[model samples]
Target: MKGISENMYCSDCGKKVKDGADICFNCGKEIPRGINKYITAENLPEEYKPISMWGYFGYQILFAIPIIGWIILIVYAIGGAPNINVRNFARSYFCFYIIAATLLLIVYLS
Candidate 1:
């Protein structure tokens, strides 16, 4: 089996870092405990509104072709958003996609 490397980016600072590194070298941001489990709305800045919402929804509808949608998501995430609810909305949208994908796959393979 081929080993796939998981990329790490600082959750708080958005700086790229080594996967196993304990802290972000770029911004000296401490990696939060259980950072991988939840994405919060408050941390995001105020410039990423329009894209994240559309980009998050696009992920579900365009799951089979993710390249474009992912690009949009990255843009929105990096740009930031003013609304505190935006991130949570996006998070729930992706969560729904997970359930929907599982059901669809089961239906298709049955």
Candidate 2:
């Protein structure tokens, strides 16, 4: 994210092009600047960055830890986590737990 603008991207390599640059540093392609259609970062609403695969894997591992993991999972699911991706994943995990518990309870009762 550093040295990259949220709005500008290299058309050839798909890397974010430097702001006001005439060429794409990533692909050495000539860039067409001053395009009127592109919206700057400031014009766009604040968005949560996408969670990387490693980040999701780490979160899942953290959530797998017993009672402490449960606490963290609950916290994240309840919007304690800043990233929407993390929060949504946590909520989905929480739902999985709920559904699992319900199934277990039904089986036990039967």
Candidate 3:
């Protein structure tokens, strides 16, 4: 017969938890006695993954393009993109452009 360690069980709901998880996703509770460690990942979740340095540089270059880059930036900023990080970046960049353009217009008018 096999025996299960108490650490293997969830503290809140007493359910079996996945090994090395920081929290019991199965029962939505913290692991007992902090036995669970943060699991290192070889590949992070796609949407959660950060944009690479080159990717940012590429995006900057893309946004410099006459028409297509602007379209892509606007679409992503308005939630057209599936990835939240990309959307956030797009929104931030769009805001920067808007601010710059507004400042330019103010300066021109003044």
lDDT of 2 at 96: 91
| TM-scores for every candidate against the unseen true structure | 0.33, 0.58, 0.61
Candidate 2 residue-wise lDDT, 63-99, digit = tens:
9899999999999999999788899999999999999
What RMSD does each model have against the real structure?
A: 15.2, 10.5, 8.1
Model 1 quality (TM-score): 0.33
What's the best-to-worst order under TM-score?
3, 2, 1
The most accurate candidate by lDDT is 2
Question: lDDT of candidate 1?
Answer: 0.57
Q: Please report the TM-score between candidate 3 and the true structure.
A: 0.61
lDDT for model 3: 0.76
> Between which residue pairs do clashes occur in model 1?
48-80, 48-81
Q: Can you give the lDDT of residue 84 in candidate 3?
A: 78
- Candidate No. with top TM-score: 3
